[model samples]
Target chain A: MKFVLALVALVALAFVPSFAGPYPLGLGIGVLGYGVLATAWAMFSGPTRYISLATVAFFGLGAYTVAVLSETLPYPVVLFVAAVIGLVVALIVGLATLRLAGIYFVIFTFGLTELVRQLVTYYEVNVTRTLGRYVFLPLGPEHIYWQLLALLAATLGMAYWVRQSRIGLALRVIGDDPVVASHLGIRITRTKLTLFSISCVIMTLAGAIQAPRWTYIEPSIVFNPTTSFLVVIMALLGGPNRLFGPLLGAVPLFLLFEWLSANFPNHYSIILGLLFIAIVFVLPNGVLAAGESLWTRLSRREART
Target chain B: MTTISRRTVLQGMGVSALATALSGLPVLAQDRTAIRIGYAISKTGPNAAGAGISTTPNYLLWVDDVNKAGGITLSKLGVTLPIEVTEYDDRSTAEETVRAIERLATQDNVDLILPTWGTGANLASGPTFDRFGYPQLAGTAVTDMAPDLVKRWKHSFWMLGGGHDYAEALVALLVKQRDAGTINNKVAIASVADGFGIDLSKAATPAFTEAGFELVYDKTYPLGTSDFAPVISEVAGLGVDTFVAFSYPPDTFALTQQSVVANFSPKVFYLGVGTAFPIYPGIAGPNHNGVMGIGGIDPDSEALAAYFERHTALNGQAPDNWASAVTYASLEILAQAIERVGDIDREAISAEISSGEFDTIIGKVKLVDNQLRSLWTVGQWQDGKFVGLAHTERAGAREPVVPKPAWVPAA
Candidate 1:
């Protein structure tokens, strides 16, 4: 029943650009892009209990890949190259930091983004002699929206598949107790690295699809650390335990951002900060979990009556 | 037991999102009697300080002034239309700036579009405005890419002097000072590590070397740097007699504050962008005297005095020394172009702007190939006021104070 409903939702989203205006379509594109980032991130980080804060590093890698290669290659081929780059970089980073855990791993991944940002900044300044690359893709708002939606669908499908697979069970065991999982014959290192690499590939593909919308790519804008933090916050806010939780968090959160930015442009950040604090304090588990609790309580009351 | 499925929640969200989007449609309707001019400015971000003094107030003043006289008189149409401004705070990010410009163009369908706050924002939005066929008369953008951008985008015009031009002018003044034995040949230069600062530094570095000045200390700091004491101490340790800082507003204030704390006083201390702002003098106090920076106005002009009074009356603050005149002058140019063409057709207005000359508060304004050719490239602070020291044409240029007086201690 859930599968059938999910399929219907995906099909409906695929046709959104047909009826929606450019503004809504643009907002949809942003929401879908964030959905991919948050969902794919939650897919690996949720089950493994490893907080990966390097979303922007992969996102920027993909954006720059498209920025540099899109001029010569097709858009789809550029996305493929970006995914490959994301996979390779994530494999190296995951291996080097796999031994570390807890706050150390979080800090390492956070530092990785800043290191990558500075390196890219230096390369652009010294080698390119240009402030940023100008992307001249012919894709319009609708095309970009469709591309982002397709990526989101693929990401959600992957997450659902991962949730049902044997590897998902193994990841959950490791997240619960790594020593016990290892003693039970689970290959902890390889499985975690694989999941991390796959998640990064999805993130990079999303970034590649969204890059043309920007039309120009600079290191600071593309590789912003704030984007990485926003992805993690969205996942945590939506409930990282469930596959669709991040999507639920991302859509409404992004819409709220757009609405607040349009209305209270000056106080948008402050309002957003307060909302984040309120969610953390009240809905500690996430909005999805809180809603489920409310539903459960109401059903129990009805049953009692 | 009743349960809420994830699918149900997703469907509900989709319905609500659609409803919200549909409801947002009515806000974009056009007002026919008003000439809608849209702009994305940095009202509350890193670039806010620059935009606060240089761009936004001038825009408001222009709108108020135009509407006060009933409206802009279109000689060709024999009718007047009041100006209506649609503004969005860009949050000082390129992505937000681009999105806001896109909204203004595609959603709002504004009659004319103003430039974003800084060089990067302007460059990011240039293609969008060009694609939409809106005339972009940039006010605060300063980049050497202006020539290429103007050529690439037909409707775009760069109002300020190019970075290379300004760098060359500053270097020329330094060379003159060096030749006159006003300052030593050794200099220290620092720049903010953004597009604007990087471009200025890149242009000035070679120019300084080519003009026979030894760069004793050189480095670039990141934007929003709170501590300049370390860099200032290093520059001071180099025993350099001249200091040149390519900076934005925040860093301009930070560097000056740190320099005073460290007592890193150079004989010729020249900071960029924000040095010409009124707040710089107000904050730096006695230390502001003898400092030189980018852009200037004729301090003695009655027009400038009147602009200051009107700006203070309207906005409760004085305009910045550098881009305020140029920003207002660009609006004046736009108003005159609209009057000449007598319509809001973007192509006609762009053509008139490309071919026409108009008198403004800044004097006779003419664009050579869509770039402002004759303007003050540099200014120096003397007696608490920024006076134009270098102009493209030296006719009305004020003589720069040589061997700048020592920094006075705060009272």
Candidate 2:
């Protein structure tokens, strides 16, 4: 029944391009792009409680791939290559850094992102001799929206499948206590690596899909560390434990940012920073957990009456 | 239990409704009497410094002046329309820049749109402006790709010439100095490892080599490097008579300060980007004199003096001596083109801009191939003012001071 409902929702979302004009479609593209990223992020970080900040590393790699190959190859082929490159890089990075836990993992991932950005910058300066590249693909905003919608659906489906599967059980165990999971014969490294690779591939695809929206890209623009931070914040704020937490968190937060930025161009950053502080203090467990608690109190009062 | 929460649904609905109302308001307003001009600029992030100094101030001054003069004339409509401005801060990101531009076009239904801050944002937004049929007179964007980009986006015009233009002009000036026996041919070059610096250095290296100047030391430091002591000491030790740094503002300030401390005074010292800024004299004091850089302005132009006075009065800061006047000039061209067309028809405005020449603060302006051919590529500090030293067309250029005076700290 739930699967059917989600399928219905996905199909409904796919029709948004038909009614919406370019403005709304552009906002939708932003929402869907972050939706996939936050969802994919939760799929790995929520289960293991390892905060990975390398999202932009894979995302930028994907964008750069599409930029370098979009002129030479078909759109679909370039997207596939972007995903493949993302997966390979994720596997290597995951193997190297997944052994560390807690803040160590977070710091390492952040370092990895900066490292990759520097490498790309170096290559562009010393090799290509141009710091910025122009991407002239035949993709419109509608095309981007549809593709991101599809990617978001796939990400949600995969998150759900991982939650129900044996790997999900093992991940939960590992999150609870890693030593017990290892004693339970869970291949901790392998399970973590596989999930991380899958999540990173989705991030890469999201980047590749959205690259054409920014017709010109450079290392600093695409590999911005702000992207990784936003994904983390959205997932955590939505209650990463829930399957739809990131989406619930992403939609409203993305809209809020769009609104704040539009309404208060000069002071939006200050307002946004205050809002993030409020979210951390007021809804530490995320909006989903807060809602669940509110529902529990209401129902209990109803039963007493 | 369903994963969709009641609160999420309520918030989403509220946002959707608000978005609908916002987009629908412009259509419902029956009186569309004003010419709505929109732009997305970097008001808050890393790019804000440049936008604040060079781009945004000119825009604010131009709009205020135009409105004070009873707005733009539309001869075809037999009426002059007051301008209504809609601006968004792009937060110095390309994604936000593109989205804001799209919103200006489709949502606010703005008649004219100005270009955004830097090379990347302006280039990123080309296809969007083309799609929406708005003319983009990019003021601050300088790239070797301008000729091709102009062809690609017909409505777009580049004010600042390519990196090669600046490099060629500076090299020609240096060759002239060398011929006068004022300086030797040894040059030390350092550039910031980014688009602006890389482009300038790449152009300058070849130009210098072609002019038979030997490169003594050439290297690039990362973007955010604060410590220039090592780089400055290394270059200072090389005993090069000519030292050129294609650096950004932060690096430029830092390099100048450290060079003063290290006493690395080359006879011919040139820094990029910020050297021609109004603030350079204030920051560098006596050291600013005879220091040449990327852009020059004709200090003798009476129109330019008035522009500077008005800009300083309104913005509480003098505009950068380089791109600020050109930016204001681009607006002059836009206004003239609009008056010529006598309507808000973007196609007509773009055509008029492409074909017509106009008098501006920068003097008789014309774009040969959708680019402003009249540009100052080199300027130097003389008698406490950053003034134009060379032009692309070899006209209206002042004679450069040779063998810059020894560094002296301000009392």
Candidate No. with top lDDT: 2
> How high is the TM-score of chain A in model 1?
0.95
What lDDT score is found at residue B18 in candidate 1? 68
Least accurate 10 contiguous residues by lDDT in model 1 chain A: A123-132
RMSD of 2: 2.6
Error of 1 at B220 (Å): 2.5
lDDT of each: 0.83, 0.89
- Candidate 2 lDDT over A152-221, as tens digits, reads 9889889999999999889989999999999999999999999999999999999999999998889989
DockQ of each model against the real complex?
Answer: 0.32, 0.50
Write down the worst ten-residue block by lDDT for model 2 chain B.
B1-10
lDDT of 1 at B222: 69
Clashing pairs in 1: none
Q: What's model 2's overall lDDT?
A: 0.89
Model 2 misplaced stretches (Cα beyond 4 Å): B1-26, B409-411
Off by over 4 Å in 1: A1-20, A68-81, A98-108, A125-131, A287-305, B1-19, B26-31, B74-78, B224-226, B237-239, B261-263, B393-396, B409-411
